[model samples]
Target: MSGDFYSERPLFGGAISSTFPLRFQDVSDIRQVPDHQEVFVDPARDESLIFELLDLKHDVGDNGSATWFLQDLATEQDAEGCTAISKGRQGREAQNLLTVYLANLRLKAVGTDVLIVAHEPILINPLSESATAVGAGLAVPAAQSGCMAMGEVFKLAVSSFKVNDWSLFGA
Candidate 1:
């Protein structure tokens, strides 16, 4: 962390921003990432961070939504032996309207460790026709030596995340 340079970087046309180490370079364009996602990568470490806007899953409960999403992601990727290493919720204010859920998963099939940080907005903006929640996922190779550092970076990014323009989500 001492050697890493952290900064707030704009995403989705500057509508949203998050702080993370500068070592991660934006690669959404080159990778042809979906419009709903902003992708960043640290090539040297083969680590990636992805921020996504998604339609809230009405069927899923808030208590363990992060773990649910993590497992869903694992299934989507056809990753086997997915195990949840940790899960928790953040934010205590009942009036904040947004609850953050975090889940760390180990995907044995892919040999990758994934940290899923999800924000579930209790009230969906009427202006937003589909988008309801925002989430950030960080992936690090299982054998990586600096996984903890990357995990810290992921936490910083999620905590510092801000919506400069709510209109980006049609608010």
Candidate 2:
């Protein structure tokens, strides 16, 4: 962790940004990811950070939204032995907007640590046609060395996430 360097990296054409280790390379273009997602990965460590824009789930209340999404992710990825480690809201003003969750799961025989940051925008983006939620997911291989550093990276990324241009969400 002491040897690692972190800085703010732009996403979605600078409309959004987060602070993370420079070791994570932007792989969205190479991977042909969806338009709504920005993906970064550190291949050597088998770790990744992804930011996604999604249609708001009106049925899901704010209080436990992070946990709900974490479970949903576990299901989507077919992860086994999923265990919720923690969940909480962000800042006072962001209480209504941000919810985060951390979990541990086994994916494809690898134990992984996953952190999810879920944000519900105050306004829905017309261009996105109801894409009102901004979500970030960090996945780090639990068996790897520097797992603790990766955990710190995940926290920093989530905490520093910002939306520079609301229009990216069609605001």
Error of 1 at 133 (Å): 34
TM-scores vs. true structure, each candidate? 0.63, 0.62
Clash count per candidate: 0, 0
Model 2 agreement with the true structure over 43-104: per-residue lDDT tens digits: 55434577766666556665675677777875554434342211122212222211223432
**Candidate with maximal TM-score:** 1
User: Which window of 10 residues has the lowest lDDT sum in candidate 2?
Assistant: 85-94
Expressed as tens digits, the lDDT of each residue in 22-128 for candidate 1 is: 87788865668777778786655444577876665556665676778777764553433542211112112212233334554333333333344533233322223
Measured by C-alpha RMSD in angstroms, how accurate is candidate 2? 16.1
How many Å off is the CA of 45 in candidate 2?
A: 0.5
Q: What Cα-based lDDT does every candidate model obtain?
A: 0.55, 0.53
